[model samples]
Target: MHTIQQSASQVVRQVLAGKNLNQALSVLLSPSAGKNGLRITSQQRGALQDMSYGTLRFYGQLVRVLDQLLHKPVQDAQVRCLLLVALYQLLHTKASPHAVVDHAVRAVRKCNAAAGGLTNAVLRNFLRNRDALLTQASISEEGRYAYPQWWIDTVRNQYGVHAGEILLAGNRHPPMTLRVNSRRNSPEDYRAILARHDIESSLIKPGAVLLAEPVPVMKLPGFFEGLVSVQDAGAQYAAHLLDVKDGMRVLDACAAPGGKSTHILELAQVDLLALDKNAGRLELIGENLQRLKLHAKLQCGDASQPDGWWDGKPFQRILADVPCSASGVVRRHPDIKWLRRSEDIKGFAQQQLSILCTLWSMLDDGGMLLYATCSVFSIENQCVINEFLMRNADGRQLPIPAVHLNNGQLFPDDHHDGFFYALLQKNA
Candidate 1:
């Protein structure tokens, strides 16, 4: 337990130092000796992941409690992060408070012997005034919501009365939803298979299923056989909205780890070209397509610089799933709350518009391009699309039939992660 705490602290420290959470964990849990020079078992890896994510998810509140408990900041970075991790375990997990404190102290001693006493005192003080400390922490919006102040402000300003719900939703554990491969099986058939395995699930749509509990992919029956692929319920709307048809030429601009790309292929027999800037991520698209017995033309190039890769043919349908602040999916990536800045949204919006314009040039007459992002921010969603329509004389926004979406913005909720979609049709 001490080792897991120690490992988790190290991961958190890296994140605080500006490393991506997933990258930091990958390096820590690599095949070689871990950061602490210990071999990580499969079980330890799971514990480490839970601790790391939980700590960051509530980092705002934990830090506030720590501030009230301590007289001065702990000089050691590792020790500070260790206390945050311990606080999260105490407040959120079913882990025993005594064990959490004991393991944290032991982990501190191994890193900085002199700070062990300080760590012990701070944690004990937190336990003694737990209720008061929690009350104080919840006073601040950041503390109460577990998101940065700017993020809270933006959501509030954009969403008005519903900002609190959006903020709270991002801190919760995301649901595990799967996109059933309709070519191979139906959601009804898959639900029966899950029932036979004693796994409970609910049908979200024609091809999407929401699991009652998230099980490892390996534990999911026929996962490798590609009967279904894990995807957000909101994301499943993309393939359907793009309206792909047999013999249509389609381009997935900025496609990588190709969830939308594969879904498009699954829906119709189209001549699909999956393009992304990163070669490594493009490999992930290949792996997904292979597992599902699908095919597409894969290309590595910048989506904004289509001149370098355009094959002189316009696509009948295009899906530009552009990148953004990723505020919508913070539950799956808690570090984004800390890593993203308010200014970053504008930069992303500019880049998104650039990609949208470039991809627009490659759209055939009457071709539809769906501009999408996994962001709840207005600047990156409606604002960008609105600007695009103004700049392009031939392009006009199309109405989306999803009744839940407010103009094209889908806020994070119990059923789906936050996502934005604006379909544009090129007038002939």
Candidate 2:
């Protein structure tokens, strides 16, 4: 295992190269390039992953602290990133500030023109100002939550003051929740099966279990056997909402990585079509379907342009898990906080509207469509649904029945990622 300092330096270089934290980590941890492409042990690998994720998760506040202490304009990208890494270690990492700076300075030396002196100066300066900087960064909401200024304001406007805090908390990495395939084995049955392998799992809800420790799916019993699969509890609502039965046609629009699509099949026999815009993502859908020994007509096509891929058929059910700001799942992908812009919400709503309008014709009369998004932003959630309802000429809002759940809107940090679901039925 490489020292955390060395790993931090590498992560710093990746960040300096203009990559977001998750992107940088992906490359650094990509078996071919991480740790100089040397194979790291499993334990070391896990630690590096944690540090990289944690550092990026709080980069906003970390940078603020760095700026306060180092009273110089940081010009070089590499050195700037290195300084950020040094500060991250000092604040969030277990490394001693002195050792952190020493190793960072050496890392700088390895570059063509080492900034060892500057690195040393910056690190020591941060150490001297640590107490002050910590206090400053912790003073405000943005500092405390580590979100962008606009993000803080936007979430506040939508979810109000309290939910805004919840939104920020949700941006932390989500837990590894799994849904057992009830068709194959009951939840308790699977829990006992996992116990034999020392895999402790606690049932959080019926059919929903949280692994005490997430192990590789390959190591889990009946994973390849299709008894359980990794899925967030928030997402499991789809199978019931669609409520597929024998001899029904179902469309899983935007079904990349096919979790919901697979779950739908698990609930009952159905003629399923899982369509995604990206071929690469569709490959994952195919792989999951194969692994589960499930059958779905997996194809790559744009949901907004169903005519291009549709075979002139109407479906009894549709799952339009459309693309949106992804605000709800930010905890699982904290990089969305950095990678996404405020304007993206408007654009996502526009795209979703197009898909909803275009795909409406594909639904059979009296058939229902479940509109869903892993986004808390109003424009992408309720507002989009309202607009679509107003604009569509033949659409009828399906009243939420006892069987059809009403998940009005979920923001982040509410036990699950924020999500919105609306079930609509067309007049037969």
Candidate 3:
């Protein structure tokens, strides 16, 4: 347990030093020989993951509590992170408080032997004044919402009375939704297959299912056979919104891990071209296509600069799933709340507009281009689309088919993660 605490602390420390949570955790958990040469069991790995994620999820509140407990700055990043992890276990998990403190103290001694006493005192102090400290932490908006102050203001300014709900929703554990391959099975039949395995699930739509609890892909029957793929229910709307038809040329710019791209292919036998900037990520698209018995022409190239890869052929349909701050998917990735900045939004908007314009040129006359993002921010969704429409006289926005969206923006909720989709039609 102490080892797990120590490793989790290291992961958090790395993240605070500018590394994203996923990359840091992967480096620590990967099966590679290192100085420690420690072998992590599956159970230990799970514990470590929970500890790291929980610590980051409520990082603001935890920091506030720690600040109150400390007389002066600890000045040691390692010891500070260790206490943070221990506090999260005591506050959130069912772990024994005695064990948590003991393990934390032991873990701290290894990194900063002299600071072990400081660690014990701070954690014990927090336990004694848990209520007072918690109340004090909630005094600040950042602490209360567990998001950066700018992020809180941005949402409040944009969403008005509903900002609180949006911020709170991002802190909850995201639901694990699955997209059933339409060509292979129906949602009702897939629900039955899950039940036969003693797994409980609910149908979200024609091809989407929400699992009662997240399970490993190994436990998902026929997962390797590609009967279904894990995808957010909100994301399943993309393929349907693109309105692809058989024998049409479609471009999935920024396709990686190929969820939307494969869905587009599954809905219709279109001539699909999946393009991404990274060679490694493009490989992931290929792997998903292979597993599902779907075929698409995959290429590694920048979406903003398509002249290098385009064969001078125009596409009847283009899906520009541009990259952004990923504000909408924060529930699934808590690190984003801490890593993103206010200025980053404008930069993302510029990039989205650039890609939208670049991809617009690739669409045939009267073709439809679907702009999508896993972001609820209007700057990345509506603002960028509005800019494109204003700049191009021929481009006009079309209504999305989903009723839940507020002008093509789907807020994160119990059913699905936040997503924004805008369908634009070109008039020659």
Candidate 4:
């Protein structure tokens, strides 16, 4: 079996190639992992995943350290990723420095034989002058906090006084919050079940519970029975604010992995039609529905073009949880920080607007459509909301709990992902 560090380097290289963390890890760890993949035990997989996340969490700083250590870039991607993984362990994790260096040297040899001596020298140098090297790297904002300068500036400009808090929160390990399936059990009962299993949790709202520490979904009580779902507290708010009712027709545009779609179904027997652009993602929705013992009409089509998917029927309620830069949930998906570009925000805003306008046309008169994004950007949040309201005379902004009017951004905190929600009602 390949060492954990080698596996982690492979995962990191995949991420650097533009795949998200989940996708990269899945490629490495999945049983059907490709020919170039390494097969390891579950425990090793967990170790690799943790190491990869730690490296990416401080990627900017790590890259800077590499810049200082190496005279030139390592041409081989795997060898470079091995260097990153080793540095992350030596600096961030509690792993023994000697062991990390030794394993990394092995990783380099495995990745490329000629690079072994280079890896050994670089790691030894870092160990000897670690303090000086790290201190030197910390002079820049990116090195100090491990986020891009443009991203840091954007957060500061957009959030003003609270920018630091958002940036700090983005680097944290996100909490694993759960939404109780109210159809089968109350939040209190589920909490009691968790207590029985020695899992400590507290209620964030009536139906949402925040674990004191995250546990695997399989470990949670009645997880397979669908007594609860792993969802962020911020995401759980969307279903609550949607106010789904029995027999009401609802459209869940851009629904994937069906977290909100399932929550809506759990709350009430809605005639929900879940739409997503990708067929592969639609399968996730189906799996979620089957596990929850709930039903929703799943459609694979673009939310931007209703002509391809929507029938002539207007829905009483719609949840337009459109795509955005995903700045709010960076703690959960650190790859977003590196993958997203400055120009992407304006493009996302335009796409969000298109979906909103198109979906609004499919809403019944006086229907409520909850517009949402896991983004703190004003362009994607307030800008799209305001422009859509202006373009559509019938669109009226309705207030909900925790919404700030000054800027529609919801700053991230311990309790929730950075999310923005705008409840709009169509005037009959």
Candidates' RMSD to native: 1.2, 3.0, 1.2, 2.1
RMSD of 1: 1.2
Error of 4 at 380 (Å): 0.9
TM-score for predicted model 4 compared with the true structure: 0.94
Model 3 backbone overlap count: 0
Error of 4 at 83 (Å): 1.3
Identify the runs in model 3 with alpha carbons over 4 angstroms from their true place: none
- lDDT string for model 2 (109-184, tens) is 6662556787788778878777887889878766777778788888788767575566567656676778888778
Query: Candidates' lDDT values, in order?
Result: 0.91, 0.77, 0.91, 0.87
Candidate 4 stretches greater than 4 Å from native: 71-73, 403-408
- On lDDT, the stronger of 2 and 4 is 4
Q: How far in Å is the alpha carbon of 38 misplaced in model 3?
A: 4.2
Model 2 misplaced stretches (Cα beyond 4 Å): 1-39, 96-98, 112-114, 124-129, 398-407
| Candidate 1, superposed: residue stretches over 4 Å from native | 33-38, 402-404
* Model 1 C-alpha lDDT per residue in residues 9-122, reported as the tens digit of each score: 999999999999999988876766545455878898888999999999999999999999888888899989999999999999999999999999999999999988988898
TM-score of each: 0.98, 0.89, 0.98, 0.94
325 in model 3: Cα distance from truth in Å?
0.3
Candidate 3 lDDT, tens digit per residue, 237-291? 8998899999999999999989999999889999999999999999999999999
